[model samples]
Target: MISATTILTFIGMATATYCSRILGYLLLANRVLSPRARAVMDVAPGCVLISVIAPHFVSSRPEEIAALAITLLAASRLSMFPTVVIAMTSLGVLKSVFN
Candidate 1:
């Protein structure tokens, strides 16, 4: 079994990654990034998502991927609070059932 600490670390890292995106936008409005760096940033999100999600999908079982896909789809239309509620509940249920 994956230790809770390992799971927590992964969640923490993902959260930090998301927080850094908001920080980048906030800092960008106040200051400027280099043109070269800005160009890279513009094309980064798709690459980053594919890189992260690809292996996650590969490693996860079908039910895990199904829940993740549903979360991703719903997140487009859902508010942050509801999204969090749904995601947490779904993950808790799925993990409990599977593991």
Candidate 2:
């Protein structure tokens, strides 16, 4: 059960986080970015994802690693709705078996 205080705290955090993103976009959207800047922006997400996720994956516990493996296996074997269902099933089984 969520208390009123917890609800307000969640709302406040969400609003602040959203405003920070909106503010950044508002500042950048008005100016035309250079070709180099645009290219960097395009590549940034993959770089950021690699940097962020690679550390977590490399540093993962055995169970988390197992779950990741299952997710990847599911990814390879399924498509569309089946892919989503298979991934979620993998997640459930992995969590139960490993954790």
Question: Ten residues in a row with the worst lDDT in model 1?
Answer: 44-53
Per-residue lDDT over 1-99 for candidate 1, one digit per residue giving the tens place of the 0 to 100 score: 546884675466456556656766877877678999888765554344445445546654865686677667766887544654565557567777787
Per lDDT, the best of the predicted structures is 1
Q: Model 2 over residues 1-99: C-alpha lDDT tens digits?
A: 335674565355445544645665777888899999767654543343233234437745765576567656664676433533454455456656765
Record all residue pairs in model 1 with backbone atoms less than 3 Å apart, i.e. clashing: none
Candidate 2 off by > 4 Å: 1-24, 45-48, 67-93
Per the 3 Å backbone cut-off, how many clashing residue pairs does candidate 2 have?
0
The local distance difference test score of each candidate is 0.61, 0.53
Name the weakest run of 10 consecutive residues (lDDT summed) in model 2.
44-53
